[model samples]
Target: MPARPPAATRRTAVGAALLGLVAVGGCDLDDLDPRSDPAPGSGEPSEPPADADADLVETVVTALSTALAATSAVPPRDRAALRPLARLHRRHLAELGADEPVEGGVASMTAAQVRSREERLQRRLADWSVQAESGELARVLASMSAAVAQQLALPAPRPRGAGGGS
Candidate 1:
Protein backbone atom coordinates (compact mmCIF):
# COMPACT_ATOMS: atom_id res chain seq x y z
CA MET A 1 0.00 0.00 0.00
CA PRO A 2 1.28 3.53 -0.61
CA ALA A 3 2.45 5.32 2.55
CA ARG A 4 -0.15 7.85 3.71
CA PRO A 5 0.92 11.51 3.67
CA PRO A 6 2.39 12.87 6.97
CA ALA A 7 -0.25 14.17 9.44
CA ALA A 8 0.96 17.76 8.91
CA THR A 9 0.76 17.36 5.09
CA ARG A 10 -2.79 15.89 5.36
CA ARG A 11 -3.89 18.74 7.60
CA THR A 12 -2.41 21.33 5.25
CA ALA A 13 -4.18 19.72 2.26
CA VAL A 14 -7.55 19.64 4.08
CA GLY A 15 -7.13 23.27 5.20
CA ALA A 16 -6.32 24.35 1.63
CA ALA A 17 -9.40 22.50 0.30
CA LEU A 18 -11.66 24.17 2.91
CA LEU A 19 -10.17 27.61 2.19
CA GLY A 20 -10.76 27.13 -1.55
CA LEU A 21 -14.42 26.20 -0.89
CA VAL A 22 -14.90 29.33 1.30
CA ALA A 23 -13.34 31.60 -1.33
CA VAL A 24 -15.53 30.12 -4.05
CA GLY A 25 -18.65 30.40 -1.85
CA GLY A 26 -17.91 34.05 -1.08
CA CYS A 27 -17.78 34.90 -4.83
CA ASP A 28 -21.54 34.33 -5.46
CA LEU A 29 -22.28 37.54 -7.42
CA ASP A 30 -25.79 36.28 -8.20
CA ASP A 31 -26.71 36.82 -4.51
CA LEU A 32 -26.39 40.60 -5.02
CA ASP A 33 -29.65 41.03 -7.00
CA PRO A 34 -30.67 44.69 -6.96
CA ARG A 35 -34.35 43.69 -7.10
CA SER A 36 -33.96 42.15 -3.62
CA ASP A 37 -32.90 45.45 -2.13
CA PRO A 38 -35.46 47.20 0.06
CA ALA A 39 -37.66 49.55 -1.98
CA PRO A 40 -37.30 53.30 -1.55
CA GLY A 41 -39.15 54.57 1.54
CA SER A 42 -39.77 51.01 2.67
CA GLY A 43 -36.41 50.72 4.42
CA GLU A 44 -36.70 54.05 6.17
CA PRO A 45 -37.41 53.76 9.87
CA SER A 46 -40.91 54.76 10.94
CA GLU A 47 -42.65 55.02 14.27
CA PRO A 48 -44.45 51.88 15.33
CA PRO A 49 -48.22 52.10 15.10
CA ALA A 50 -49.67 53.47 18.29
CA ASP A 51 -51.25 51.01 20.70
CA ALA A 52 -53.38 53.34 22.78
CA ASP A 53 -54.48 52.17 26.22
CA ALA A 54 -57.10 54.58 27.50
CA ASP A 55 -57.66 52.59 30.68
CA LEU A 56 -53.97 52.66 31.44
CA VAL A 57 -53.82 56.42 30.91
CA GLU A 58 -56.78 56.89 33.17
CA THR A 59 -55.22 54.70 35.83
CA VAL A 60 -51.97 56.66 35.70
CA VAL A 61 -53.77 59.95 36.08
CA THR A 62 -55.75 58.63 39.01
CA ALA A 63 -52.67 57.30 40.71
CA LEU A 64 -50.91 60.63 40.23
CA SER A 65 -53.85 62.55 41.65
CA THR A 66 -54.05 60.23 44.63
CA ALA A 67 -50.36 60.47 45.27
CA LEU A 68 -50.45 64.25 45.15
CA ALA A 69 -53.44 64.31 47.45
CA ALA A 70 -51.60 62.06 49.91
CA THR A 71 -48.97 64.75 50.32
CA SER A 72 -51.33 66.53 52.69
CA ALA A 73 -49.58 64.75 55.57
CA VAL A 74 -46.42 66.66 54.77
CA PRO A 75 -45.87 69.91 56.64
CA PRO A 76 -48.27 72.67 55.58
CA ARG A 77 -45.45 74.60 53.95
CA ASP A 78 -44.26 71.55 52.10
CA ARG A 79 -47.78 70.67 51.05
CA ALA A 80 -48.26 74.20 49.81
CA ALA A 81 -45.03 73.92 47.89
CA LEU A 82 -46.38 70.79 46.18
CA ARG A 83 -49.70 72.42 45.31
CA PRO A 84 -48.69 73.23 41.77
CA LEU A 85 -47.82 69.63 41.08
CA ALA A 86 -51.12 68.58 42.60
CA ARG A 87 -52.92 71.01 40.38
CA LEU A 88 -51.14 69.69 37.37
CA HIS A 89 -52.28 66.18 38.16
CA ARG A 90 -55.80 67.44 38.70
CA ARG A 91 -55.71 69.07 35.32
CA HIS A 92 -54.43 65.86 33.78
CA LEU A 93 -57.22 63.88 35.37
CA ALA A 94 -59.74 66.34 34.01
CA GLU A 95 -58.24 66.37 30.55
CA LEU A 96 -58.01 62.59 30.51
CA GLY A 97 -61.66 62.44 31.66
CA ALA A 98 -60.66 59.81 34.19
CA ASP A 99 -64.12 59.29 35.64
CA GLU A 100 -63.53 55.66 36.51
CA PRO A 101 -63.53 55.14 40.25
CA VAL A 102 -60.14 54.31 41.72
CA GLU A 103 -60.46 51.59 44.33
CA GLY A 104 -57.66 52.22 46.81
CA GLY A 105 -57.20 54.80 49.51
CA VAL A 106 -54.18 57.08 49.43
CA ALA A 107 -51.16 55.87 51.39
CA SER A 108 -49.35 58.34 53.62
CA MET A 109 -45.91 59.26 52.28
CA THR A 110 -43.18 61.74 53.14
CA ALA A 111 -42.24 64.64 50.90
CA ALA A 112 -39.32 62.65 49.47
CA GLN A 113 -41.59 59.68 48.77
CA VAL A 114 -44.05 61.98 47.07
CA ARG A 115 -41.32 63.32 44.80
CA SER A 116 -40.18 59.81 43.99
CA ARG A 117 -43.75 58.86 43.14
CA GLU A 118 -44.08 61.85 40.86
CA GLU A 119 -40.86 60.88 39.10
CA ARG A 120 -42.20 57.39 38.58
CA LEU A 121 -45.48 58.72 37.24
CA GLN A 122 -43.63 61.00 34.84
CA ARG A 123 -41.63 58.10 33.46
CA ARG A 124 -44.80 56.07 32.99
CA LEU A 125 -46.48 58.95 31.18
CA ALA A 126 -43.53 59.34 28.88
CA ASP A 127 -43.59 55.67 27.96
CA TRP A 128 -47.34 55.68 27.46
CA SER A 129 -47.14 58.72 25.24
CA VAL A 130 -44.93 56.83 22.84
CA GLN A 131 -47.61 54.17 22.55
CA ALA A 132 -50.67 56.43 22.42
CA GLU A 133 -52.59 56.15 19.15
CA SER A 134 -54.10 59.62 19.18
CA GLY A 135 -51.65 62.32 18.19
CA GLU A 136 -53.34 64.81 20.46
CA LEU A 137 -53.27 62.50 23.45
CA ALA A 138 -49.68 61.63 22.82
CA ARG A 139 -48.79 65.30 22.65
CA VAL A 140 -50.58 65.91 25.91
CA LEU A 141 -48.78 63.05 27.58
CA ALA A 142 -45.46 64.31 26.29
CA SER A 143 -46.18 67.76 27.66
CA MET A 144 -47.11 66.33 31.04
CA SER A 145 -43.96 64.22 31.03
CA ALA A 146 -41.82 67.29 30.39
CA ALA A 147 -43.62 69.20 33.11
CA VAL A 148 -43.03 66.46 35.69
CA ALA A 149 -39.38 66.12 34.65
CA GLN A 150 -38.91 69.87 35.04
CA GLN A 151 -40.51 69.76 38.48
CA LEU A 152 -38.27 66.89 39.49
CA ALA A 153 -35.16 68.81 38.47
CA LEU A 154 -36.00 71.66 40.83
CA PRO A 155 -34.47 71.72 44.32
CA ALA A 156 -36.77 70.34 46.98
CA PRO A 157 -38.41 73.05 49.05
CA ARG A 158 -36.69 73.79 52.33
CA PRO A 159 -38.83 72.90 55.31
CA ARG A 160 -40.05 75.87 57.28
CA GLY A 161 -37.54 77.12 59.91
CA ALA A 162 -34.81 74.85 58.53
CA GLY A 163 -32.00 77.49 58.69
CA GLY A 164 -33.30 80.25 56.41
CA GLY A 165 -34.45 83.34 58.25
CA SER A 166 -38.16 83.54 59.23
Candidate 2:
Protein backbone atom coordinates (compact mmCIF):
# COMPACT_ATOMS: atom_id res chain seq x y z
CA MET A 1 0.00 0.00 0.00
CA PRO A 2 1.15 3.59 -0.57
CA ALA A 3 2.63 5.24 2.50
CA ARG A 4 -0.04 7.25 4.36
CA PRO A 5 0.19 11.02 4.38
CA PRO A 6 1.83 12.65 7.48
CA ALA A 7 -0.39 12.65 10.59
CA ALA A 8 -0.66 16.48 10.50
CA THR A 9 -1.77 16.35 6.85
CA ARG A 10 -4.35 13.66 7.60
CA ARG A 11 -5.76 15.69 10.53
CA THR A 12 -5.94 18.83 8.32
CA ALA A 13 -7.78 16.91 5.59
CA VAL A 14 -10.26 15.47 8.11
CA GLY A 15 -10.98 18.94 9.64
CA ALA A 16 -11.56 20.43 6.20
CA ALA A 17 -13.94 17.58 5.26
CA LEU A 18 -15.88 17.91 8.52
CA LEU A 19 -16.18 21.72 8.18
CA GLY A 20 -17.46 21.36 4.60
CA LEU A 21 -20.07 18.78 5.64
CA VAL A 22 -21.31 20.92 8.52
CA ALA A 23 -21.58 24.07 6.40
CA VAL A 24 -23.41 22.28 3.56
CA GLY A 25 -25.64 20.27 5.92
CA GLY A 26 -26.90 23.41 7.66
CA CYS A 27 -28.03 24.95 4.36
CA ASP A 28 -31.49 24.02 3.04
CA LEU A 29 -32.14 24.39 -0.67
CA ASP A 30 -35.91 24.84 -0.14
CA ASP A 31 -35.67 27.34 2.72
CA LEU A 32 -38.19 30.17 2.58
CA ASP A 33 -36.81 33.51 1.48
CA PRO A 34 -37.32 36.29 4.06
CA ARG A 35 -37.71 38.79 1.23
CA SER A 36 -40.94 37.09 0.19
CA ASP A 37 -42.52 37.37 3.62
CA PRO A 38 -45.84 39.23 3.73
CA ALA A 39 -45.86 42.86 4.81
CA PRO A 40 -47.98 43.93 7.74
CA GLY A 41 -51.40 45.45 6.77
CA SER A 42 -51.04 43.76 3.37
CA GLY A 43 -53.94 41.52 2.27
CA GLU A 44 -55.56 42.13 5.64
CA PRO A 45 -57.72 44.72 7.38
CA SER A 46 -55.53 47.57 8.66
CA GLU A 47 -58.28 49.35 10.58
CA PRO A 48 -59.82 47.95 13.74
CA PRO A 49 -63.59 47.58 14.17
CA ALA A 50 -65.39 50.91 14.68
CA ASP A 51 -66.59 50.13 18.19
CA ALA A 52 -63.13 48.95 19.22
CA ASP A 53 -61.54 52.12 17.92
CA ALA A 54 -64.11 54.23 19.76
CA ASP A 55 -63.52 52.34 23.00
CA LEU A 56 -59.74 52.68 22.67
CA VAL A 57 -60.02 56.40 22.00
CA GLU A 58 -62.26 56.84 25.02
CA THR A 59 -59.84 54.90 27.20
CA VAL A 60 -56.91 57.05 26.06
CA VAL A 61 -58.84 60.24 26.71
CA THR A 62 -59.84 59.12 30.17
CA ALA A 63 -56.29 58.16 31.04
CA LEU A 64 -54.92 61.49 29.86
CA SER A 65 -57.49 63.42 31.87
CA THR A 66 -56.79 61.33 34.92
CA ALA A 67 -53.09 61.98 34.57
CA LEU A 68 -53.77 65.69 34.25
CA ALA A 69 -55.80 65.64 37.41
CA ALA A 70 -53.08 63.74 39.23
CA THR A 71 -50.60 66.49 38.45
CA SER A 72 -52.77 69.17 40.07
CA ALA A 73 -50.42 69.51 43.04
CA VAL A 74 -47.25 69.97 41.05
CA PRO A 75 -46.41 73.73 41.43
CA PRO A 76 -49.00 76.19 40.08
CA ARG A 77 -46.75 77.14 37.18
CA ASP A 78 -46.40 73.50 36.20
CA ARG A 79 -50.13 72.94 36.56
CA ALA A 80 -50.84 75.95 34.35
CA ALA A 81 -48.34 74.67 31.81
CA LEU A 82 -50.11 71.28 31.75
CA ARG A 83 -53.60 72.75 31.27
CA PRO A 84 -53.12 73.27 27.54
CA LEU A 85 -52.20 69.62 27.13
CA ALA A 86 -55.33 68.58 29.01
CA ARG A 87 -57.41 70.94 26.88
CA LEU A 88 -56.01 69.38 23.72
CA HIS A 89 -57.00 65.91 24.91
CA ARG A 90 -60.46 67.20 25.78
CA ARG A 91 -60.81 68.66 22.32
CA HIS A 92 -59.92 65.33 20.77
CA LEU A 93 -62.37 63.56 23.05
CA ALA A 94 -65.11 65.96 22.01
CA GLU A 95 -64.28 65.44 18.35
CA LEU A 96 -64.55 61.69 18.80
CA GLY A 97 -67.93 62.07 20.61
CA ALA A 98 -66.48 60.12 23.51
CA ASP A 99 -68.42 61.34 26.56
CA GLU A 100 -66.69 59.15 29.10
CA PRO A 101 -66.14 60.84 32.48
CA VAL A 102 -62.54 61.58 33.35
CA GLU A 103 -62.02 58.89 35.98
CA GLY A 104 -59.65 58.89 39.03
CA GLY A 105 -58.77 61.33 41.82
CA VAL A 106 -56.07 63.96 42.12
CA ALA A 107 -52.71 62.83 43.44
CA SER A 108 -49.47 64.75 43.83
CA MET A 109 -46.90 63.88 41.16
CA THR A 110 -43.32 64.92 40.60
CA ALA A 111 -42.31 66.48 37.29
CA ALA A 112 -40.72 63.18 36.31
CA GLN A 113 -43.93 61.28 37.10
CA VAL A 114 -45.91 63.70 34.99
CA ARG A 115 -43.49 63.25 32.12
CA SER A 116 -43.68 59.47 32.40
CA ARG A 117 -47.47 59.45 32.35
CA GLU A 118 -47.54 61.78 29.34
CA GLU A 119 -45.09 59.54 27.48
CA ARG A 120 -47.23 56.48 28.13
CA LEU A 121 -50.40 58.30 27.04
CA GLN A 122 -48.67 59.53 23.89
CA ARG A 123 -47.71 55.98 22.94
CA ARG A 124 -51.22 54.67 23.60
CA LEU A 125 -52.76 57.43 21.46
CA ALA A 126 -50.34 56.62 18.64
CA ASP A 127 -51.30 52.93 18.77
CA TRP A 128 -55.02 53.74 18.79
CA SER A 129 -54.53 56.15 15.90
CA VAL A 130 -52.96 53.36 13.88
CA GLN A 131 -55.95 51.11 14.56
CA ALA A 132 -58.68 53.72 14.02
CA GLU A 133 -61.23 52.73 11.34
CA SER A 134 -61.93 56.27 10.15
CA GLY A 135 -59.24 58.31 8.48
CA GLU A 136 -60.48 61.50 10.14
CA LEU A 137 -60.43 59.91 13.58
CA ALA A 138 -56.95 58.51 12.95
CA ARG A 139 -55.74 61.96 11.94
CA VAL A 140 -57.13 63.46 15.14
CA LEU A 141 -55.57 60.81 17.36
CA ALA A 142 -52.22 61.15 15.60
CA SER A 143 -52.35 64.93 16.04
CA MET A 144 -53.11 64.60 19.74
CA SER A 145 -50.31 62.07 20.19
CA ALA A 146 -47.85 64.41 18.50
CA ALA A 147 -48.97 67.32 20.67
CA VAL A 148 -48.50 65.30 23.86
CA ALA A 149 -45.07 64.12 22.69
CA GLN A 150 -44.05 67.71 22.02
CA GLN A 151 -45.16 68.80 25.48
CA LEU A 152 -43.14 65.97 27.03
CA ALA A 153 -39.98 67.47 25.59
CA LEU A 154 -40.60 70.84 27.28
CA PRO A 155 -38.88 71.56 30.62
CA ALA A 156 -41.04 71.56 33.72
CA PRO A 157 -41.44 74.92 35.45
CA ARG A 158 -38.82 75.81 38.05
CA PRO A 159 -39.99 76.12 41.65
CA ARG A 160 -40.21 79.63 43.11
CA GLY A 161 -37.23 80.62 45.23
CA ALA A 162 -37.93 80.54 48.96
CA GLY A 163 -36.24 83.94 49.42
CA GLY A 164 -36.81 86.76 46.92
CA GLY A 165 -33.13 87.58 46.44
CA SER A 166 -30.75 87.78 43.50
Candidate 3:
Protein backbone atom coordinates (compact mmCIF):
# COMPACT_ATOMS: atom_id res chain seq x y z
CA MET A 1 0.00 0.00 0.00
CA PRO A 2 3.02 2.32 -0.08
CA ALA A 3 3.82 4.65 -2.94
CA ARG A 4 6.23 3.46 -5.60
CA PRO A 5 9.73 4.94 -5.91
CA PRO A 6 10.30 7.66 -8.51
CA ALA A 7 11.45 6.49 -11.93
CA ALA A 8 14.96 7.79 -11.34
CA THR A 9 15.15 6.08 -7.98
CA ARG A 10 13.88 2.82 -9.48
CA ARG A 11 16.46 3.04 -12.24
CA THR A 12 19.19 3.76 -9.73
CA ALA A 13 18.14 0.83 -7.58
CA VAL A 14 18.11 -1.51 -10.57
CA GLY A 15 21.52 -0.30 -11.67
CA ALA A 16 22.95 -0.80 -8.21
CA ALA A 17 21.52 -4.29 -8.02
CA LEU A 18 22.98 -5.14 -11.42
CA LEU A 19 26.35 -3.78 -10.39
CA GLY A 20 26.28 -5.86 -7.24
CA LEU A 21 25.48 -8.95 -9.28
CA VAL A 22 28.40 -8.38 -11.59
CA ALA A 23 30.77 -7.73 -8.71
CA VAL A 24 29.74 -10.67 -6.59
CA GLY A 25 28.58 -13.33 -9.05
CA GLY A 26 30.32 -12.42 -12.26
CA CYS A 27 33.89 -11.87 -11.07
CA ASP A 28 34.22 -15.12 -9.14
CA LEU A 29 32.59 -17.76 -11.34
CA ASP A 30 34.57 -17.50 -14.56
CA ASP A 31 36.13 -20.84 -15.51
CA LEU A 32 39.86 -21.37 -16.02
CA ASP A 33 40.76 -24.67 -17.57
CA PRO A 34 43.61 -26.44 -15.79
CA ARG A 35 45.50 -27.45 -18.91
CA SER A 36 45.37 -24.05 -20.59
CA ASP A 37 47.35 -21.34 -18.88
CA PRO A 38 46.95 -17.81 -20.18
CA ALA A 39 49.57 -16.86 -22.73
CA PRO A 40 51.69 -14.04 -21.41
CA GLY A 41 49.69 -10.92 -22.32
CA SER A 42 49.40 -7.24 -21.58
CA GLY A 43 46.73 -5.15 -19.85
CA GLU A 44 46.09 -6.70 -16.44
CA PRO A 45 45.21 -10.39 -16.75
CA SER A 46 41.98 -11.44 -18.44
CA GLU A 47 38.42 -11.61 -17.04
CA PRO A 48 39.04 -14.39 -14.56
CA PRO A 49 42.37 -15.56 -13.28
CA ALA A 50 42.67 -18.85 -11.44
CA ASP A 51 41.76 -17.43 -8.03
CA ALA A 52 38.80 -15.21 -7.18
CA ASP A 53 38.00 -13.06 -4.17
CA ALA A 54 35.59 -15.70 -2.90
CA ASP A 55 38.35 -18.31 -2.88
CA LEU A 56 40.60 -15.92 -1.03
CA VAL A 57 37.88 -15.33 1.52
CA GLU A 58 37.61 -19.06 2.08
CA THR A 59 41.33 -19.38 2.78
CA VAL A 60 41.33 -16.31 4.97
CA VAL A 61 38.44 -17.83 6.86
CA THR A 62 40.50 -20.91 7.62
CA ALA A 63 43.59 -18.99 8.59
CA LEU A 64 41.42 -16.69 10.64
CA SER A 65 39.88 -19.68 12.37
CA THR A 66 43.31 -21.16 13.00
CA ALA A 67 44.54 -17.88 14.40
CA LEU A 68 41.37 -17.72 16.45
CA ALA A 69 41.96 -21.15 17.90
CA ALA A 70 45.43 -20.14 18.95
CA THR A 71 44.31 -16.84 20.54
CA SER A 72 44.27 -16.18 24.29
CA ALA A 73 41.72 -13.39 24.67
CA VAL A 74 38.36 -14.74 23.62
CA PRO A 75 36.09 -15.43 26.57
CA PRO A 76 33.50 -18.24 26.68
CA ARG A 77 30.55 -15.85 26.26
CA ASP A 78 31.27 -14.79 22.66
CA ARG A 79 32.12 -18.29 21.48
CA ALA A 80 28.69 -19.17 20.05
CA ALA A 81 28.90 -16.72 17.14
CA LEU A 82 31.88 -18.62 15.81
CA ARG A 83 29.85 -21.71 15.05
CA PRO A 84 27.93 -20.00 12.24
CA LEU A 85 31.05 -18.41 10.82
CA ALA A 86 32.85 -21.74 10.85
CA ARG A 87 29.90 -23.39 9.15
CA LEU A 88 29.99 -20.68 6.50
CA HIS A 89 33.67 -21.43 5.94
CA ARG A 90 32.95 -25.14 5.74
CA ARG A 91 30.25 -24.57 3.15
CA HIS A 92 32.46 -22.25 1.15
CA LEU A 93 35.29 -24.81 1.29
CA ALA A 94 32.92 -27.51 0.08
CA GLU A 95 31.99 -25.40 -2.91
CA LEU A 96 35.67 -24.70 -3.54
CA GLY A 97 36.38 -28.45 -3.38
CA ALA A 98 34.01 -28.95 -6.29
CA ASP A 99 35.81 -26.25 -8.32
CA GLU A 100 39.29 -25.98 -6.76
CA PRO A 101 40.76 -28.16 -4.07
CA VAL A 102 42.21 -26.77 -0.83
CA GLU A 103 45.54 -27.91 0.60
CA GLY A 104 45.08 -30.16 3.63
CA GLY A 105 41.65 -31.72 4.14
CA VAL A 106 39.86 -28.71 5.57
CA ALA A 107 36.57 -30.49 5.18
CA SER A 108 37.86 -33.34 7.26
CA MET A 109 38.96 -31.00 10.02
CA THR A 110 36.66 -31.32 12.98
CA ALA A 111 33.86 -28.79 13.41
CA ALA A 112 34.81 -28.38 17.04
CA GLN A 113 38.32 -27.39 16.11
CA VAL A 114 37.05 -24.98 13.49
CA ARG A 115 34.62 -23.48 15.99
CA SER A 116 37.33 -23.05 18.59
CA ARG A 117 39.66 -21.44 16.10
CA GLU A 118 36.99 -19.11 14.75
CA GLU A 119 36.15 -17.97 18.24
CA ARG A 120 39.73 -17.01 18.96
CA LEU A 121 40.21 -15.35 15.60
CA GLN A 122 37.01 -13.35 15.96
CA ARG A 123 38.11 -12.02 19.32
CA ARG A 124 41.53 -11.08 18.02
CA LEU A 125 40.16 -9.48 14.87
CA ALA A 126 37.63 -7.55 16.93
CA ASP A 127 40.43 -6.29 19.12
CA TRP A 128 42.61 -5.38 16.16
CA SER A 129 39.69 -3.82 14.34
CA VAL A 130 39.24 -1.58 17.35
CA GLN A 131 42.92 -0.67 18.01
CA ALA A 132 43.83 0.45 14.51
CA GLU A 133 40.99 1.43 12.22
CA SER A 134 43.57 1.04 9.45
CA GLY A 135 47.07 -0.28 10.18
CA GLU A 136 49.69 -3.05 9.83
CA LEU A 137 47.67 -5.83 11.40
CA ALA A 138 44.70 -5.06 9.23
CA ARG A 139 46.95 -4.80 6.19
CA VAL A 140 48.54 -8.12 7.04
CA LEU A 141 45.17 -9.79 7.34
CA ALA A 142 44.08 -8.28 4.04
CA SER A 143 47.33 -9.40 2.42
CA MET A 144 46.81 -12.93 3.64
CA SER A 145 43.43 -13.03 1.93
CA ALA A 146 44.95 -11.79 -1.31
CA ALA A 147 47.68 -14.43 -1.12
CA VAL A 148 45.08 -17.08 -0.60
CA ALA A 149 43.19 -15.79 -3.64
CA GLN A 150 46.34 -15.96 -5.76
CA GLN A 151 47.06 -19.49 -4.62
CA LEU A 152 43.52 -20.51 -5.39
CA ALA A 153 43.92 -19.21 -8.91
CA LEU A 154 46.82 -21.55 -9.65
CA PRO A 155 45.76 -24.71 -11.50
CA ALA A 156 45.39 -27.58 -9.11
CA PRO A 157 47.95 -30.31 -9.65
CA ARG A 158 46.64 -32.93 -12.03
CA PRO A 159 45.37 -36.01 -10.28
CA ARG A 160 47.27 -39.31 -10.65
CA GLY A 161 46.29 -42.57 -12.40
CA ALA A 162 44.29 -43.39 -15.52
CA GLY A 163 41.01 -41.96 -14.31
CA GLY A 164 42.64 -38.96 -12.66
CA GLY A 165 42.44 -40.65 -9.32
CA SER A 166 45.01 -41.45 -6.63
- C-alpha RMSD of each candidate structure in angstroms: 22.2, 20.4, 17.2
Q: What are the runs in model 3 whose C-alpha is more than 4 Å off?
A: 1-30, 36-77, 98-166
Task: Report the C-alpha lDDT of model 2 over 88-141, residue by residue, as the tens digit.
Answer: 666655655557445347677766677787788888888986887655556666
How far off is residue 164 in model 2, in Å? 10
Q: Model 3, clash count?
A: 5
Ranking by TM-score: 1, 2, 3
lDDT measured at residue 4 in model 2 versus the true structure, 0 to 100: 81
lDDT, candidates in the order shown: 0.64, 0.61, 0.40
Candidate 2 local lDDT, residue 161: 63
Summing lDDT over every window of 10 consecutive residues in candidate 2, give the lowest-scoring window: 25-34
Off by over 4 Å in 1: 1-52, 99-104, 164-166
Q: Which residue pairs show backbone clashes in model 1? A: none
TM-score of 1: 0.59
Q: Who is ahead in lDDT, 1 or 2?
A: 1
- TM for candidate 3 is 0.27
Native-to-model Cα distance after best TM-score fit, residue 54 in candidate 3, in Å:
14
Model 3, residue 159: displacement in angstroms? 47
